[model samples]
Target: MFPFFFDPTMMLLIPALLLAMWAQMRVKSVFARYSNVGSRHGTTAASVARALLDRFGLRDVPVNRVSGNLTDHYDPRDRTLSLSDTVYGSSSIAAIGVAAHEVGHAIQDKLDYSPLRIRNAIVPVVGIGSSMAFPLFFIGILFRGQMLMDLGILLFLGVILFHVVTLPVEFDASSRALRVLADTGMLSSDEITGAGAVLRAASWTYVAATVMAFAQLIRLLFLRGMFGSRD
Candidate 1:
């Protein structure tokens, strides 16, 4: 019998859940609004991305078109930049902001940014920890095994650390994207404002995710009797 089926500890997740919802809605609204506003310079997203990458001395990084909206990313592992369907050919402010953000990651990788390097290094271990955390915790609860629960808490700790580290990486990337856009004259002052707004709105999603991860960890700890008393 699972005692936590009706556990009150789950109440701790409500604030983060609400924040996550609001962040999703806010980003989507902002992105859609700016996506309709085309760049005055009339440059394709891929061309802009390539130009930025080359300017940053990353000529070797290939920019590729990919399907799906907002699927854009820079893969440090392969040194490739992928632009999503919504951004690959568009000349909109939203598209350019997205392209530049991914490029920011490439720049980070090129410079060997410490946080990013640490994040990339932990990816493998975090994968294992995330996959096992919940299952191990539930098994521990079912058997009243203290060590198993403690191990679960520890494994989940890696996931929490990942979320925390991601916050600064993302914020720094946005800052780089905005600054580069302004410096290269890729976007005018007003256009830069628009792109900055899009990036700023999108950042809340990561904030929400980090908050949710922390809340989950707290809930796990409470269940383990590390803090609050269990009924």
Candidate 2:
């Protein structure tokens, strides 16, 4: 059996894994802290989202409550905004922040944001790539097939590219959310600070994910000894 812990590739991945773990913890901690603090206006998350969408001339976009924690999203395909149950009705700063962030995606879609359009166009390919990457790579290794291994690496790179694209999309959404919230008077300056903290913490998770994916890709290259030769 391969001793993964002692592997140099694995050793190099440790920092990225630790950073991802820390980012996850930070998002949860910050979100939880602000989730318990009610909004100054005592407005529910759904109301805030609806109001923002309307302000942006997106009255056609409907907000719906769905079950789950932090599962809020704006589905561009259906032109619907879905908020998790906790966020939909909660009159909390965290809830409002999350809701607004999702609305930012709707705005992005409405405006045809270039990164978002590219990201959406590649979703299916990324899904297929992610599903096939592991099996193809493992089989190629077992059979010592260089072509198959190269194809597997190519597919995995698509997955990595997806993560890379996601960074800008998420960051832009958070930026739009904070700015809109402030401009619309949905949150006071101090409250916007707390919301910004939550959004920033959430953004770190995407950064960590991208870093981890890149590290994993590098580890794979190292494991295959692809860096040693000019093919």
Candidate 3:
């Protein structure tokens, strides 16, 4: 059976969940507001990414348009920058800012950012851990097998570690994006402020995610009676 809704550890996780909800709202609000405002230079997100990559001597890194609202990302494996539908061809400030952020990841790959490198290395393991954690835990509990439960907790730790490491990677990308935008004068001061607002809001979501993962791990530990004399 699951823990009670009002259990102490469960209560502690409420704030993190609320913060995550708030972060989601903020990201959507800022993106929606700025997505309507066109940039002064009137350049599409794809064009801006290309310009930044070229400026950074990364002309070989390709920028490709992808389908989705906010599915933009940089593929380190292939060294490609993929922008979403809203960002790829749009001339809005939000689009350009998002494109720049993904390009920032590409920059990190090129410069061999240590945290990013570590994140990439563990991605496959994290993927497996995330998917198997809950199933293993539940199956172990059903069979009253301590070893299986322990193994599940161990795998779940990898998921937590991935989220923890992701915090720095995301923040660094945003910092790099803002710096590049400023140094190149690609966006006016006011425009940069707007873009910064959007990126900052987006970064909060990552923080919320990490907090949520930590809370989940702690809750699992509590359920496993890891806290002595608590059961």
Clashes per prediction?
A: 0, 0, 0
Any idea what lDDT model 1 has? 0.92
| TM-scores for all predictions | 0.96, 0.94, 0.92
What's the CA error at residue 122 for candidate 1, in Å?
0.6
Please identify model 3 stretches exceeding 4 Å from their true place.
1-12, 226-231
- Model 1, stretches more than 4 Å misplaced? 1-4, 226-231
Q: Residues 1-231, candidate 1: write the lDDT tens digits.
A: 336566888999999999999999999999999999999999988999999999999999999999997889888999999999999999999999999999999999999998899888889879989999989987887778777888888999999889888988899999999999999999999999999999999999999999999999989988888322333
The number of residue pairs in model 2 that clash at the backbone is: 0
The residue-by-residue lDDT of candidate 3 on 1-231, one tens digit each, is 346334566776898999999999999999999999999999898999999999999999999989988899999998999999989999998998999999899999999999899999999999999999868865765666666777888999998989988989999999999999989888998999999999999999999999999988887777667422232
Q: Clashing residue pairs, candidate 3? A: none
Best by lDDT: 1
Q: Which wins on TM-score, candidate 1 or candidate 3?
A: 1
How far off is residue 92 in model 1, in Å? 0.4
Q: Best TM-score goes to which candidate?
A: 1
Residue 104 alpha-carbon offset, candidate 2, angstroms: 0.4
